[model samples]
Target: MIIRHFSSLFIAVLVISVGCEKTDRDRFNPLDPLNTTTGGRPQGLQAVAGHERVLLSWADLAIDAVTSYRLRRQDNGGNETIVDLAERPLSATFIDSTVVNGQTYTYRLSVLIQESEGGVIQESPASVPVEVTPGPNICWIADEGLTQILTMTSDIRAVDRQITSIFGAKHLAVDPRNGAAWTTTQFGGADGAVAVRFSSKGVIDRTVTGFTFPASVVVDPRDGAIWIADIGATVGEESSVSRFNQNGGLLFKITGFSEPSGLAVNPNTGACWVADRGNNTLHLIGDDGTILLNINGPGQPTAVSVDPTTGDAWGINVATQQVFKIRSDGTISLSVSGFIQPVRLACSALDGSCWVVDAGGGQVIRLRASTPDGYHIGQQSDFHLSLTDFFVPVDVSIDQISGQVWIVDRGDGSVVKIAANGSIIRRFVGLALPVALTVDAGPR
Candidate 1:
């Protein structure tokens, strides 16, 4: 009986000892406390503004303890969204590309801490809210009739702003590097004609002086340098191409051209191709004022354009009614005749196609690359259209992305947008003798 009672007491002691061991383990466990305790909040939260997005960054306080991060965002209208950073737990930066331009946004950050082996999750406090507002996508248009530069949305819905002080604003080009539009004044003093760089808000930032007759302006695609074609006061004397930095400071000038009319720069090669009517030659110039190739033959080359895809240059001769293609190696590859006084040309960067403006015919011609087995080397006319509303189209610009063509009708004082299929999209009227037109690759 005593042995049985001792065995029962030993079993009872064993049971109590095991229970006490379990209780101690639960009370002193390091991982148990971590599962219940939250980590430190994220610090140094910041928001950087972008065209249509906001970039957020933060300093992780308990990076070693955090298993994931949570990003919270709220707009000015009080809409909220929570984003989990499970895939990039340690990433300190996040780009909120879903944001809209011109809208204010607030952001906060927090961290999720979990004990090893999948313990309870604890969330730290959110960081202080950071606010940011993005810049809107805008288009700049030069109006010769109104003698002003108009800022409008990409959809051409409304005129956001206008700079009315600019007189004789014949041609304009946008410098994407600084959101400033450079325009040429046809009439100026003895020193030379003036080109004014105006901000998107219609503020004149700087005036570039000393151009004899600034007829055309283009921005270098490789760099943001400005190139102006100065048609000299005389027939062939002093006609030159001038290069200017983004600040309107003259970089250098290239002389000895008879009459530099149209200008285009190849983004890949940084070569400026000028159509000089005085000498009836296509001058391919380097960034450092080096004449890489001067091909003489196209009768009175009026306008020149560089194909972004193939680096091929195209020039239209209004006198000969012919279009010539210059290869990247500075050789005349092909020439197509039978156009009615093609004055201006714009080539697409997305494709090797081009658009030609025929002032004599009052029409625009669309040219595209021939098929694999076709005879033409560079391009051939796909179709030609004479818009019923156009009287005399002077200049043409193409939106490479959307394949939209913008034509400046000088005779009727209108700017018309046409789709790639020769369909008229929209026409903006009520301008006074619109001479030049350009399209910006807004907010890429």
Candidate 2:
């Protein structure tokens, strides 16, 4: 009888131990008001303000214990509201389109978890509030010497945000449709010829490799496709132009070029104009990888730009110090000389005018199109800046909304904003080798 009593006691102890073990079915009590929170708060909460909208995103929760999220938004006037998210599997990003532009908003996020079989809930602590202001215009600047990308305010008086750690960031292009930016890294890192895409919130969205030496990149304003010019490993060896989707997927790659240094996409038709410096040729390639027109004899055309107002493409031959306007039908309508080392040209959509940056001349010259190919150079009313204003001006872009020319002076390490009437609006100084600048004035 004593032995039977001992066995009963041992069985009772085993049952108690098994009951004490935690099981997967055990729910966390998130509603406990004793300040002991179970689930952790959302991390890396970032808010990007846009035109009448704000995008909020956070890192994924480390565990699968979260059942829902509670996002709280507060405006500048102390008005608070909880965003209604009804999806079961919550997304990491939320776009609040009900926001108004120019108004500041603050946001906080928390996690909610089921704590019991009866649907009792527990809430994680709210994240720190993030504040942002929406604006219509922003400028993206790429500094190769500093290896950084900077976003400047609409007025060009202050920097809105800066993203560092980019290696050999030579050039950048912004997509006005989504506010994302794409750039090519020319040096350093294991992946030397790499291209990176940054999201609207300044986060690395995607990185595409396998380029030999990407010289320039541009976005198709019509369809948001990305075009890259890989100058190849060596001159006249494996040079190519590739097209990528907005998500960084390779759509198509057009090969057989000799150092395609400059790429310009036709804003209306999504076609690409490839300037091959090594072969001294200008190629007009269709979006479907077909060579529509190949014109030889532009004297090493290194840079090209298209005017959306007219389908004509303008190219600059650095070796010849000349600019050529190529008509849409594969014919050179006009070839103008007398430029002192014209490195880049940007055609304005506002008036079909082209702004040329002459590094040797140290001037930004504006040329208005009279015909399809001709810019009236001998005309007395041409807009020309004095050479004293710029030193080694490498790139030029136009603000379509305001028709102001933005010039990147690499030697002076500054970006100059000039009004259409030949007045300096703002001179953004103290940059480290600013190589490229693109203006984003919302959607056209």
For candidate 2, the TM-score is 0.68
Poorest stretch of ten by lDDT in candidate 2: 30-39
For candidate 1, the lDDT comes to 0.73
Clash counts per candidate, in order, are: 1, 2
**Which 10 residues in a row give candidate 1 its minimum summed lDDT?**
370-379
Task: State which candidate has the highest lDDT.
Answer: 2
State TM-scores per candidate: 0.65, 0.68
Instruction: Name the lDDT value of residue 219 in candidate 1.
Output: 88
Per-residue lDDT over 1-444 for candidate 2, one digit per residue giving the tens place of the 0 to 100 score: 999999999999998878766333344443333323434455678887665777788876635556777899998899998974648577889989988766777899888777565687777788778887665777788988887898876555556688988877777898878889898976637866798988877898788998877879999987788999987747445878999988788999988887888989998899999998888889888888788999887789999999887889989877768788888987788876667778889988778877888898888777767633434343434433343488899887777676777888999889887877568877878888998988777753
- What are the lDDT figures for the candidates, one per model? 0.73, 0.79
Pairs in steric clash, model 2: 30-122, 31-122
Name model 2 segments beyond 4 Å from true: 1-135, 235-237, 371-388
**The best candidate in terms of TM-score:** 2
